[model samples]
Target: MWRYCSLLAQLVMHLDTFRVSRWLKRWRPPPWPALLLRVAVYSGLWWVITEGSGSGWLGLVLALLIALCAPLNVATWPQQLRWRRLPLFIGFMLKNSLFGALIVAQLALSRRCSANTHTRTYRFRLLKGHPQQLLMANLVNLTPGTLTLRLGCDTLSIHILHYQPQIEAQLMMLESHIAALYGLDHEPWEYEY
Candidate 1:
């Protein structure tokens, strides 16, 4: 009975240690780039709300306030960008955005066109931080056809306006570009799609 009790106590201690380690791993200081993005978005919304009036200066202040007040729940800061790859990524986004817009317009304007909308959950290979998930969500939301519905641990639930076999490929390509922007070198096993 003494030995069994000792084993049970040891197991409880080990479980407590595991829980503490997991908690420590999850909590981290937020990064600067994320703060900057929040500030920019808040400021942009303020400007829009004020309608380009003489109150633009006030908008900037409000933006700063909101950004500072917002809670940050980052696990780890995303990897730094490879500055050399930024232009390429930007160009890729712009080009794809233009085409996506054109396709959306065609689907909208053509009476005979039928859009096969579908939602899919994609488990990414290399995306790690919340920042990467946020960026991917925004990118998908902004693109004409795809709407990012939810982001979960290692999974993105996206609604595609026009579902096609190639849509998954396009999304993977987009993810790769984003990974490049984050300076992540992808390992084949890290990606599910």
Candidate 2:
């Protein structure tokens, strides 16, 4: 019985689906430039939270700890942010959010309702990360007509107060903007009908 159990264990370890080779692959550290950038951001946040306290070492240690703990993926790093484009993106979001609020208000107050509202399961191409995906979901919810009902591995189910086919186009544009913001691979955008 012991011999049979040992053979079973070895066979299980060698199973095709249980390949340990992937873990044996080289584990690369994040780029120095990105790491430095994260440390800076974390330091700034710490400064804000601490209200400009002079406890410098605390902030530095915290920043280093957080940066080291962050997932080591070049594509998902916050350091990829195009600082020059952030203002433009912020302006875009503000304008859209205002527009969405106004539109939703009008629909709510108008006699003819349900004219353009839609529900869709939009499949996004953005690299999957909790932070990025959560940002995308929250941004969509902030928009007037759209509310993110569910966020999946590569899909977001949204309920729009005002539905139009053109909303899909708008979402694609939003996704593209987000992709640029995060320095993610620009995968061709596709959606389920």
Candidate 3:
């Protein structure tokens, strides 16, 4: 009986230690660079939304609040964002946006528009709950004729206005660009029709 009691006490101690370690890990502050980057990005977004209406103090304050309140997983950010690839990613998105606009314009102006709209479910190579996955979904919505209907754990359901052979290729390219931005390898995944 005494031995069993000792073992039980030991187990309880181990469990407590595990809990403490997890708590510390969860509450620890993020790295300085990552924190600063978050603040800058948030501030920039606020500025863009507000169109530089008033003093930048409110934007700075909001940025700080958001940065501090958000969960900071330092391990992910360093591996996720590659600063060198930012320009390429932005340029790719802009170019795709332009092409998408042109396609939409052509379809709109045509007298006999043969629109064959369909929904496609593509398997995303990015891991579930990854920030880049959400960003990619938003970008898809911004692109003309393509709207992200559902973003599941491993699948993305997109509504395509006009089914084109090159649409899948463009989506793949866009995914690759986003993966590159996140410093992740772009791998082919099984997609559903």
Candidate 4:
């Protein structure tokens, strides 16, 4: 719970950190046009996830709620203009979420996806004590079959739902994904420890 709150607080902090009034002196974004673009993206997200889950009105209402949030989402619009991230921003969210869902699902359906198993344990040698390992470990726990038992200073021990050849590879891939997503790999040398 504390972690969740910290993440939310940081996100809200970052969103408000940029001031458009101060920013517009240096760069411009088509405010209404950009707002429309944001609305469209939110609509698309609403369509993708709730498309089949509920009635049309509920989806529309949900999408509108998401649209309502967009203005607050654009705090860095001017800085984005400075960086010219327009093309990248135009791209849709790729459907790679399936891999994560499938991994969680496999852990769920198998009896091993619980907090404990009859005789199950797995140990991981972290490349270093990256904080993301905790998230990775918690994800392992949440997927029904596993739980993170211990996070030693440099190692993680998790009770497995089940073990297989590709699991480590999957975790490694997830680590790289997380690192790239957050640009952790490019952090200044002073942060490496």
Candidate 5:
């Protein structure tokens, strides 16, 4: 019984050491600039929501809380984002959205509506659960006729109202733009139409 108790105590000591090391490894504090930026952005949003009301103390507390927690969840800091490429990405999305809208409008007026509707799953090149991947999914959903049905680890399932061979190319372009915005380098993958 004494030997068993000694072994159990040794195991508990090992677990405590592992837990301490793991906690230490993940305990990095947020950079000062990122924390300040988050505080400023959150405070501005609170101000807008409150319509310049004199609830300054509440806003400050809320802003601080959110700013402190933001770093824990974010994969990349806002400072690391490629701001210069954002305009070009926005333009690309807008152009594609316009074209998609035109195609949807054409399909709506035409007699054959469901003839070209299709659900295709494209293999994603971006890392799973990355912020860029989420943005890509949102942009795809924003475009007419292409709704993101499901976003998986390595695949994105989309419902296209008018299936075209070029749709995959468009998606690849959008993915590349988003990857650029995030300063990520990934090779485009081929998908069957």
Candidate 6:
């Protein structure tokens, strides 16, 4: 029993170390481009919310985190990008945020959701264990009419209610947004419509 306890303690200690390392990377990022991105994110938030003094403290902290620590959960962060992609990525996120808000509003206004509505299920076959993908899955789950279920170590199964061709197209578009934002080096064929 003592042997087992000692092994457990060692494992827990290692996990703690890993978590601290990740936290430091974002919460206290190294100098240069990372700092620039962090500042940009915070300034954008300050503009969007438009509150003064202590009121924006939470937003400031969160913005700093989203800007700095995002790489921990987002695989694409380590990659560098051409400056040209910056505006395009922001536009993509803004659009996604708008769409997400609309989904929430519809769900709130409608007294009932059609239980019989058609849904399409997709299995992301051989999905790797990626913190970034996990973040995306969580975002997907937050939107109404969509759910990311059974997120596993190596796969994801997504469910969408109210199936339509446009939605599929939109998902494809999102793929491009992610690739661009993260500076993923995809071949031309992958990005082709």
Model 1, residue 32: what's the lDDT? 85
Error of 4 at 79 (Å): 16
**Please, what is the whole-model Cα lDDT of each candidate in the order they appear?**
0.78, 0.78, 0.80, 0.52, 0.77, 0.60
* Tens-digit lDDT track of model 5 for 127-146: 44456677878899867678
TM-score-based ranking: 5, 3, 2, 1, 6, 4
Residue 102 in candidate 2, Cα distance off native in Å: 2.1
Return model 2's CA RMSD, one decimal: 8.7
Tens digits of per-residue lDDT for model 6 on 1-193? Answer: 9999999999989988778765755653446767677767676767676754435667767777666655556435543545688798677667776777787577667888553344454433222237546755775664445677666654456677656557655654555555555555354432221
Residue-level lDDT of model 2, residues 1-193, one tens digit each, is 9999999988877773665555434335557987788889999999999999759889999998788767533346654567888998999999999999898888878887756656789887664767777889999987668999999887899998766768888887888788778777455645445
* Candidate 6 residue-wise lDDT at 58: 71
Error of 3 at 7 (Å): 42
Question: Which of candidates 1 and 2 reaches a greater TM-score?
Answer: 2
After superposition, candidate 3 runs with Cα above 4 Å error = 1-27, 39-66, 69-79, 186-193
Instruction: State TM-scores per candidate.
Output: 0.58, 0.64, 0.64, 0.33, 0.68, 0.47
In candidate 1, residue 166 scores what lDDT? Answer: 87
Greater-lDDT candidate between 5 and 6: 5
Q: Between the candidate structures 1 and 6, which one is better when assessed by lDDT?
A: 1
Model 2 residue runs over 4 Å out of place are: 1-30, 69-76, 109-116, 125-134, 183-193
How big is the positional error of residue 147 in model 3, measured in Å on the Cα after superposition?
1.8
lDDT string, candidate 3, 90-139, tens digits: 88778878888998899989999888999999777544455778888999
Q: Candidate 2, residue 96: CA error in Å?
A: 1.1
Q: Give the lowest summed-lDDT range of ten residues in model 3.
A: 71-80
**In model 3, how large is the Cα lDDT of residue 163?**
86
Candidate 5 Cα deviation (angstroms), residue 25: 12
